[model samples]
Target chain A: MSGVWGHSGNIEPMFQSATAEAVEERLQRPRGWNRRNSLPYTLVFLIVAYLGVFILFPIAQQFLTSFSNNVVGVDKVTWVGLRNYERLFEDDDFWFAVQVTFTYMVFVVAGAVSLGLVAALLLNRKFRGRNLARSAIAVPWAFPEISAVLVFLWMCNPTFGVLNIFARLFPGIDANLNWLSDPNLAMPLVIALSIWKAFPFTFLVILAALQAIPREIYEAAEVDGANPLQALRHITIPEITPTLLLMAVLMSIFSFKQFTLIWLTTGGGPYGGITETLVLRIYQTAFRFFDLAYGATLGVSGFVIVLGLTLLFVYAQQRQDRARRR
Target chain B: MNRPGNGLLLPRSLSMGRRDFLKRTAAAGFAAALATPALAQNAKIKIPLVSWMWNEPGRGDAWRAILAKFHAEQSDVFIEEAGAPFNEFTNNMLIQSQSGKINGALFHTTPDLVVRLLRGGHLEPLQDIVDKLGIGDKLSAAHDHLRIDGKVHGLDIVTVKFGLLYNSAMFEKAGLGAPASVEEWVETSTALTKSPDQFGIYSPHLMSEPGDFWFILQQWAVMFDGVWAEGRKPQVNTAPVIEGLKLFKTMYDKAMPKGTDTATANQMYANGRIGQQLIVSAAVNIWSSSGPDIYPSLRSVVPPGPSGKAITRIHPICVNAHASDDEKAAAKLFVEWLYKPENYQELMERCLDVVPPYPEAIRQEYLDKQFWAEGYLAGKSITPLEIMGDYIFFNQEFGNVVMDKFSEVLVANRPVEDAMADAQQELEKASERLFEGFTL
Candidate 1:
């Protein structure tokens, strides 16, 4: 255990044994006897308590609510075990919302990350007005969501939207297009707005990650007769793959819970919930339809989907880490 | 520490010991605690009157004047304005109610919202106030839904009935008189439209504004003598509804400002760009201020459809059951004062409202003076409860299904019959779960 902190070739086993011994010793000590050791445990307990109240408790409430007949204005809100879940499985609209949520998540995640990477790579180079360019790219992220939606609504307005100006530049689009009302265009327009509002954040994070990579790595690749593309492929990409993965996970979560932008813009419609995500559906069900029990059921199902996504991403990350080590 | 500028030692009396400072602070806090109720008792009972009308253009000012008059006349109660915009108001109140109480001691409820609140037991019955005012028998039939177990739970502050409100100036420009039939209405609208500049008609169709969209959509069905539901059964796939939707689609394609939001469309209407709107009569007040030029030319007609019936909705102001006894009493006092024939008539005249909750609530002389009232008065009145049957309790939900499917007809060019068939099936399926224990 003493050699755990020493420069040893067998460091992993020594560290594990030392950790085990420390835990055993701490447990054997009288409560509050070791203030230094107790500090970390106290902080951990505080965090757990915070999470339990703010996150876990509400989730538990929603889970309990999912099994009840708790609709607003109902005569009795008695427990109706498994009834809501049974209905969920047969509900077509709920399934459509799930599909829409995933589609939105994928497109937004991919679009934001790709656009972020491109912008980051471009801005990372030595260029004139680079600072100004970086500041400009961050504007969208800084802008309030409601304001952005308002501006976007104005720009996509059928009669007077500025979007029509650019749209009519192409032949055969002679009339002002119904940018959001058209079912074919609603989802795409909403996705584009989400990406625009989201990509700036990804750009800032990816830029910081790019700056963290040593310039020597690129120089080393250049000295070995590597072209710019080869250097980018071998040196730059490999160094940032982990950051990109992390961004994808973060973006997925951001888009998964996105409500204001979608709710404000298309309101989960042009027709038949073309843009309805799980969040919007939960809201419409609970607030609009006054079906709290079913809304909770939908929420629980969404929580499961999110949990599955997180586990899948964790597994992928673990595999990637193992590959990196190899 | 030395005092600034003077550069002299501070007086010994200026500094106090920590214990003395703590004692003084605690004494001040204790004094405040003791004095608070006395001060509050002396002050007016500041119970907030929550209403979406507070955010509306003409209605807001009208209500504010009424509130001012109330303040001038009363001393014990003070009503503060609170609530969100029209679009968010119902859901905000619903959310508040779901959490055990509404946001304010007194709040306004839409035609559908009062029913939910009444069933949820969130309303304090105002039958006593009505009886005191002796207007219970004079109350319009629209107030029937607000009754539960023989007690009136709310008092209608405004009764909004739909009509084909059009700009006679625009009609004159197009050399078209008011249409006599549905086919004539379509031809007139198409003829009046000059795309990219002016639209012939605008009824809220955007899903982004489902509250307005669904509210107006119900009237569209009514225009053709159709109801969305009957006895918890949907009549969406029926012939009259199909005809109503087809007419809407034809107008959408040929005459509407396809993607314009209601606010912008209203501005367009004010500016004489939109020729007509199937709007509530209460909305006429907006033109008096915002569209002074066009307001004079504005005239309403019975919807030139087979039915010639308009859906009349009553927005009621209710006292919160969850409020304290003092607050509830104060709210009821305000309601009683506002419902007096003189005050109510003044409110109607100030708001330029044509409909009244009771006959004596309005003056025949005032009605005669309103040049635009003829058509609104001529139409047969149908309440939402009658048109929707038991589904009136789930008005927004029923409207959502209808609006969602019909959006396909407007957007994807899906046939109205096919879209409506899908809607009929969806509604049929939803009824099983939505109306499990619901009694109307």
Candidate 2:
């Protein structure tokens, strides 16, 4: 019997050895291969075919569509090579979208990660109802995005919102502060809502990493007269550097592609496309204006920007991993 | 014989029956998957309709019941509903148009969208539908907006007339009557306003999706006799337009709920805290549902301005040009069935926001059931058909320019002249680029 009790403590290593042997045997043989290993080969073929049809094909199609005069819903395609790109470069709206997108990404990434790290540190400490606190912290992340957005929109109402009601108590704050309509405050409020919705996953990840750290290392550091701040700087910082770097890359990617939060709240308005992110601009160009080719061009440009950032972060992470190993 | 990279060889002792069974199962699954769509294609004459009306509460069930009745009457025909949220339906139509494969045979959308679809040549000519019905003389003046080159392109089901919808209770409480001109309008709004709690007026002054700021602000623009376009050329940045922009800015500052969009404004108005607003005829039903006492006290007047005109829009139904012949025939049949006098007025009454496009629809029996009948028919001081003089379709080109520049002026507090000039230049550029070779 291969059950745990029957095989005793050494079963794991034995199972690993058997898996290695099976792989070696499979590699060494060549005759009747289709009949012998049909299942895995069929599974892999299915996966590749699925990805090629749904994922890679659309991406390639978009790249080709960007150069053509494919006016949406019309059965005509005129090849207009590089003119779409030229137009994209010249358009003032495109540049404004780029500037706003990067600004939004930076603020959201920093705010979400910092808040997440703080929450993680607090929850990691031993206390009563710690488990309950951990569960409660995840509620924001689990909340439906549309529901949260609607609630926030109501709360930010200039006339009768709870937020405006509270603001009246402060000495200098305008009682009827237009949080969403004011161009100055709209983006900040959008960013705060995004941070609230996204920080929980970061909190959970950081908490797991924190719990994995050796208690003995912290105890020794304390015995040597190291204070909490010193321990955090020398021990916690170095230990969690990899996770932090990873989270930064992921959060940056998420922020750059975010559409629903910003679109639902501001829709690039209160003024003329002031809050328009690249994704929102692409949607407007494609669906609203029906300039399909121009929208595709904008999409490709955004993809390149995000891909470049991702590669840079990955390279940095690799360098850090090498330094840690040394 | 096998190649090196082919990996493991099967033992000669392995059974062939198991392998055959698996192969047969996979083949059967693939065949079944391929057969489903083929079977659907040949089943019945399915006429699907893509519309946002199904998003309304009672309308969805009414639509389904109508379709069921049609199906029962015509056993060979199937009516498929492809209803979605407004934004999603618009997006779906765009994608379908790009792919040149429209899923629905018929579609229902606003006049603005009808113009866009017509410009793209995505709509089938509905002149035959009108000619056969012989209701050309009965058609309202608003149908002029749906005609292209003397050919009917779509059929109007319902329309919204823009006017001043006021809470009579508030007006009485403030010892004010409905305003007749621009100055009176402002004075009444200010008199009715009592800071922080009760706003005198509620309209979406911000650029909002699903509802453009222009829809509300255009009433003011038209009242001031500002022409948005003459032929294909932009006539913005005129003196009248500048005056209209200034009036809107003042209204925003003195009366409107700051930073509120249409949804918020609608909610506030429904709660009876708002005094008056530029609202559509359909909103009477919406407000009535929220406050029973408020409905009885509600009153409407053609909002006064220099020209004494306001903006009104009609939503229309159009057939997909790409639909198959059978589907098109079925769609026509369904529409004919839908507009039979008994069915048409009953459906219109269920949703009080929309008025039927036919003048005959306002027959005494229909008005008796309509909640806004007094404002719409009896007094008839609000002349929706003739008040605006001509029915001009608000196309995407004009909408984009108006919404953006107006937002900059109203929300950003930009100088009216500079902003209007910017809007004029943008409109000219768009016309030059978009309408360069097209027949307007």
Candidate 3:
């Protein structure tokens, strides 16, 4: 885990014995900040850089695994030119995993953000137990993801499951649905669990944004012959849209990167490799299969995809916001 | 049906068959692939018993008892049994075994690994230890599991058979004695499938790993006609293999009861509804739990085979070769003490109708009292050693490739001979490229 500011050679010796004048100069504050604070900055940089070796290095290692042509039992690398990448490209299973991931993110984000906004708008006024409810919404985020996944696995069990028993009351629905086992059902079930586990974050963010909206703007709207709906649309929504966009981006990244929950409930199997996310693939390749190079390749692929989407999103959002501002 | 987001390549399985063909055509060659414990010279040494089964509660706790007994006032040296899940026990030890993080491990993997482990000097050579310990004198030809390149790797528990473990009541109704041969097993299975209401055997074909189809079929093949490993080469695709396939296909085709959906089934037999479970004998504890409402009454008899002898596959036994000299010596001594008939009897007697590993370990007094076998059935004892010794499990690379081919025949509906041909082709290829890394 190397810090971005780290050096290849030891910087420790450079900072080992700084003169008193240098130390004193670094401590002194000036109007434009003329003095070089190399000692303190280097120390901070090195500390951060040290953490990168453990954390970032392993991540880099996973990215490396996804590319290499290492078989589990075999010890040599045959270096099949993009053979792994080529295989991954043609794999119907990986395509399904990608679709599942997209569906999960899109459906979850839509459900959580819209529902969260409504809840936040409804709870805008001071009410009894309001703070308690707001805090309670954040509670799901604190529960361990593994525990939540297990709970979902149990609730979704086809036989003797609580959800199936209750679902039976519906006239046309099957009495038993092996939610996790069905390739058709696993993603939707995972989407439901993801929404359940994640909506609270949206609620918290939206509620904070809602509270921060100035009452004066709404008062002006009301005075201008705007009904409650128009006032919310014209004033409230415009005010919180920026924060909502930011939260959406963050939440999208969070959902895309979510691993533990999916890994726990369904070991990314049943669809013959469809359920496995790129991250899960990285994990399996690096740890389970010990194809570190291939695991690393998965990480790199996941990174480029996620990064490209995020950048494209930010660029589009910025352009739209700038035009509106002008 | 839709394309995956960020999917960069085709799937492994679809391409595996084709790539395997090309690779096998290119490789088209073959190759061949432990030891007893060492005594702790100074009594200050400690070595690890890296095994898988000890992860279960009783076995893990019972390991402590054995260690305690061995240390019985022997002042200083200690032995620790560190167990992980079956899958992880070896790979975890590999880092230590390679980097010398920890000494010796007891694990099971392809027999092809023996040459690499010995080549990199990752394991201590053990033929000398067996000679020094005089264990060979006690047991005839038992150390073959470890013998590779004319050297030994580790002492191993023999192979146990994968077969139909039937209830006596069901057998009475079917009028089938222990299947005397593979043909009889097929006949009995088809007969017992009598009405749509009952099935002869319970098998988990859909279990995650396809390897299990081989685990059971190999036992049957070994009995009828014969498939074998000589100098660690799998001369399968023999008559025995074809006969074994037909036998299994016969069972799967006509036997398995309807409504016994095995999707992600963790325990089909624990509930005890199946007349007979075709599974490994390791599940005895699940069937032996108190409360008839909860558990099932189960016993095992040999499925009569082509040779009139029912054999099984054995879990492997190994010692750490990478331990310090003193530690290696002590590990050998400890293992020797452990394999002594008394200790062997102690471990084998628990929780199942397990056959003893060593021939001399099962005495009348010990067999009668051990917890797993006590009065569960009329059978006095069933030792895993009744199955082939290390020859099948650890001596050769053939069983694995043959097993995969067998799966092709059974599940994929490939012709038995064609699949065997493909299997032999692939296996011959796999044997050559098994290990190329020389780093220690």
Task: Name the top DockQ candidate.
Answer: 1
The collision pairs in model 1 are none
Query: What's the lDDT for residue B199 in model 2?
Result: 81
Each prediction's whole-model lDDT (CA):
0.89, 0.75, 0.58
Candidate 2 residue spans exceeding 4 A from truth: A1-30, A73-76, A165-171, A223-225, B1-46, B61-78, B208-210, B288-291, B339-343, B368-401
The A-chain TM-scores of all the candidates are 0.89, 0.88, 0.80
Q: Candidate 1's residue-wise lDDT over A1-326, tens digit each?
A: 22322232333442366687666753554553244446789999999999999999999999999999987776567899999989999888889999999999999999999999999999999999999999999999999999999899999998889999999999999988888988889999999999999999999999999999998988888889999999889888889998999999899999999999999899999988999999999999888888889999999999998888888888898899999999
Candidate 3 lands at a TM-score of: 0.67
lDDT of 2 by residue, A253-321 (tens): 999988888887888776767788999889877776677888899999998999999999999999999
Which candidate wins on lDDT? 1
Candidate 3 docking band = incorrect
Residue A142 lDDT in model 3? 84
Comparison by DockQ, 1 against 2, better one: 1
Q: Write the per-residue lDDT of candidate 3 for residues B95-139, one digit (tens) a residue.
A: 444343454443333333443344445665666655665666554
Two-chain DockQ for model 3: 0.03
Q: What lDDT tens digits, residue by residue, belong to model 2 across residues B156-184? A: 76677777788888889889988877889
